[model samples]
Each structure stands twice: as C-alpha cells, then as structure tokens.
Target: MSSSEPRPESGPTVPSVLTWGTWAAVVLVAAQLVLGILMLSGSWSLIEAHAGLGYAGTLAAVLAAVSAVVWKRRGGSAGVMAHAVAMPVLMIIQIGLGSAGVKWVHVVLGVLILIGLIGLPMSLRSARRQSL
Candidate 1:
C-alpha cells in the first residue's frame, strides 16, 4: 500500500441490491397496473391481491432508496440518491389515493411511479460509471 500505487476501485457498491430492488418494484407496479385494469373492467376479486402487491412494491421501493443512500455514502451521485428516494414517497401517495377511492389520480400516479422505477436502474448505472 505505497502512496505511489493506485488503490483498487470499489465498483458500483450495492449494485445488486439497488438495481434488483428497483427491478422488483418495477415488476410489481406493472402487475398492479394490470390488476387495476382488470378491476376497472369489473373484476373485483383481484382487489385484495392488488392491495397486497402495492404494499410489497412500496417496500421494494424503500429498499432501493435505502441502498441508494448507502451508495451515496460510498461516493455515488446525489442526483441518483434523490431519484431513488422519490420512488417510495410516490408509492405512499399512490397508496393513499387508492385507499381514499380516488381511482383516476391513483392510476395516473401509479403510471408515473412505474416510469420512475424503470428509470432507477439506468440512473444507478450512470452513477456507477461516473464513480469509476
């Protein structure tokens, strides 16, 4: 460990947790969207499953956000951290809207959350590359 020697790069710390968590959240949101469509078409039986998956998706989003914070502490981008943190917040609001019977707003917010989840991995990758 001489001063003149280059240290080994700690590439993309927490990539698996952050990236996979985001992907899981994305998949859950997509499934929820399908369930929502079915419910709108009068398939009320799927509502319980939809509600269950919403909580799971929110948990996954929270995991992603926490991992992003860990990544930032390990020298990742602040922007990426902020982006990851937004997902769970959006999920909570979306859940509230759904619980309050505000169908239209809930659906729109769900779509936006899905879009954000889809973008999370790309942001993580970009931050990793920048760090390297």
Candidate 2:
C-alpha cells in the first residue's frame, strides 16, 4: 500500500478482448433474432438470401462462448460462462422452432433471444465489477 509499491488502479477497468468479442457476438445474435422474426412472419422473404447470416451469427456466438470458457478457466467471470451457454442453446431452439413450422415459437424465441443478447453485455460488466 506504500507509494513505492504498485498502486491499486481506480475507476472501472476496460473490458478484456474476450469481453469485447463476446459483446460483438451478442449484438450480432440480436440482429439475427430480429431478422428471423421478420422472416417467419413472411414480412421478409429475403430470408433465403440471409440464410448464411444466421449461420454466421451462430458461428460468432460459438466462438464467443469458447472465448468465455477460456476466460472462465482463467478465473474471469461467471456471467461470461452463462452467456456462452445460454446463447448457443437459444440459437438451437430458434432453429428447431423454425424447422417445426412453428412460426409463433420462432417469434417468441426471437424476442427472448434479443433480450438475452442485450443482457449479456450488462451481465458481463456486472460480473467483472463484482469479481473485482
């Protein structure tokens, strides 16, 4: 605690690279949810063209989840781990609903996924702060 010793930093620390990457994935997943809802409601037939978009979002989420796992292993954040798990499961549920011809399920899941996506970053911040 002496001045000659290393001082504790003040203010909030910047998020880690993995944290930022995870946030980006969450944003993309939110976008995917919106697009999926539009597609299911027949408001957007461009779904076919954007099929790869969902896949890309899924891949990003998977990568984010993997990053979260690594971060958690390094004693990072529980929020990150939860985000990693929730997002992929939600993505799978969305896919299953779409395939089952259950448009309403897709719609509901889309909204829920969007909520979860937005929550991910907040949760990460909260977790990091609490851990610190």
lDDT by candidate, in order shown: 0.86, 0.67
Taking all chains together, each candidate's TM-score versus the true structure is 0.87, 0.72
| Residue-wise C-alpha lDDT for candidate 2, range 18-126, written one tens digit per residue | 5666677666766666676566677677675445555666676677677777767766666568776778778777777866878787778767776776777777777
Give the TM-score (vs. native) of candidate 2. Answer: 0.72
Q: Could you give me the TM-score of model 1 versus the true structure? A: 0.87
Q: What residue runs in model 1 are displaced by over 4 Å at the alpha carbon?
A: 1-14
Candidate 2: which pairs clash?
none
Best by lDDT: 1
Put down candidate 1 lDDT per residue, 43-76, tens digits, no spaces: 9999999999999999999998998898788766
